[model samples]
Target: MSSDIAQPTTATGHARQYGDRALQTLLSANRALLRAEQVNALYQEMCRIIVETGGYAMAWIGIARHDPGRSVDAVAHYGDRDGYLRDLRISWADVANGRGPTGTAIRTESVQINHDFECNPRMEPWRERARSHGYRSSLSIPLRDERAVFGALTLYAREPDAFDGAELELLNQLAEDLSHGVRHLRLRQEHAHNARLLRRSLFATIEALTVALEKKDPFTAGHQRRVSRLSARIARELGVSDFDIEGIRIAAQLHDVGMIQVPSELLVKTGPLTPDDYDLIRRHARAGFDILEPIDFPWPVAEMVHQHHERIDGGGYPRGLRGERILLGARIIAVADTAVAMNTAKPYRETPGPDATLQALRDGRGTAYDPAVVDACLHLLRDLREAA
Candidate 1:
């Protein structure tokens, strides 16, 4: 691509113009790094800024591969309107093709400037390709990680000696900043991957505990699972974010964890529970909180479990939190748990069925249950019925 800028009449004017482009490129590079979220995005933006903002004819980024061929993979480019790199094949090995600006820059871990791509003997391999693309000069800057150079940012200019001392200084600084951006983004990506792995492990452990509890109490065998499913659905209908929905689902699955501390006989008893027995069962919420409070969860899992039994009217649970004071996840779980429990059959009572469960939620909306959660749950149940 042509530089497409007015040609300066004097040598002084030329140098001044070059300096301005370099400064603009550096500023744009800084902004790109701050806004960039991934390494590939950074590479693509760097090339684009160098071409459009710096007034380079063409620009591209190539990663040096350590495979058998030691090939340079052209990962990102701009201003290649003619597809200049379409059939490009280059390497970093000590071979003929590897002696070009991009390969040499990576090999030497320094900047490589081909002042005159037409006359330079080292440009023999790519000379024709360069001429065909109207590239008179080129600059290649090595991109490095914490350890060593891993890639090259190559730029082509319409004028010979386009990259002079002042411009070269700024371009070199841009390359350094680009390298740092790449390293930072890669580390962030790796950290996110590790965090996901750890979260999965934690979920597995929670699932095991839930399974053990279910095994101990046959009456509530699949109650937690049903609650988890309904809670997640209600959260989605309420437009809760994916991250918060995951937390709600997990909390709902483990909300009954406190019952493990209660006597198995009391849990399985078909007879009416005495007031003391009822109070003991009420203690399960706090017990579940204590069981989960020590674990380092990314979400408010312990608090959600503790507040699952809470009511919006400040009439329920250990703390009696009112209105918005109750955690949203817990509020969602409360609606789901109540609905699932009423619908599911128990040894001590007959199943109330879905119609009765919906009526119960409608009756308690706003006073006992969160109005919005009840609305979302009502919509979800309607959809389920329609789908059925």
Candidate 2:
């Protein structure tokens, strides 16, 4: 087997060389931590950095598991060109395999160094494997979590007495940084999982509210769903982002939720209503806002519901929010709501054909509706007609 028997003439010369490499390893590892997004990716990068930057023959990370056998599993490794770890097994228990640098460092929660693997009795179990891989020295540093040591970062060197003094100190710091980075990434992943769960629960609650409104008003049975579809299409046509379009669609679905507070008879009345009836009908926007304002939604859902009826020129609604004052989602919902209502058969008004609806949108494009949203809606309607 090939061996690294060459040595520096002076101890000071070896220290200087090792110090420079260790400093580089520490710097590169710190930078990796800043950009690391996944634990496995970080582990792999650390092993690679240890070998490439510190000039080690091989490097690996082992996670200590409290399984039935108290095993230490090699999670990530680099530079084992001959696959020296293919049959390697280790444990933290006081066994033959566990007596090595890796297991002993983790077991004692400290650094374990073997300056000359050939002369070390602990290396007896895997001496031939180490020699075959050209590993004459090794260092293992325990990686800790908040509770206790969770893993070990082990580095193998081609030359004996490769790690010492300043070099070992810097490598220990690198291990500590890696442990903290792993813990942080896991916590972030868990928080994101919780956020997804919370979003699902919130959507469930919104669906139930929509169902209640549908039960109360027959006119609104399928109106919200249609408006939501058209609003999403219009938003997409206008180059709105997918995430914003999702919020727009959800707001459209619940835009008329305030109608739940309106009298059922008023909704179904075929006869001309007095000014008082019309005024009460207009209050639904404010009522919907009040219903949703207290809930913490990730999107501006409540404001969109409140301002869906508001005109761009300050001519409509519970609040006369003019021009840019209206939320973009609210503006999109307005056009969608208008298009759906005009084409649908209403008890008090005749159903306007697609041609008439298109004219009305053209007539009010910039005055009552956002010009861009109206254009998108017209484009969608024309496509639907042509497809039909």
* RMSD over all Cα atoms, model 2: 3.9
TM-score of 2: 0.89
Q: Model 2, residue 377: what's the lDDT?
A: 86
TM-score of each: 0.81, 0.89
Instruction: Return the clash pairs for model 1, or none.
Output: none
* Top TM-score model: 2
Model 2: which residue pairs collide? none
For candidate 1, write residues 207-314 as lDDT tens digits.
898998998898888889888999999999988999999989999999999999999889888878889988999999999999999999878999999999999999
Task: Give, for candidate 1, the lowest lDDT window spanning 10 residues.
Answer: 1-10
Q: In each prediction, how many residue pairs overlap at the backbone (N, C-alpha, C within less than 3 A)?
A: 0, 0
Cα RMSD, each candidate? 5.0, 3.9
* TM-score of candidate 1 relative to the true fold: 0.81
lDDT of each: 0.88, 0.87
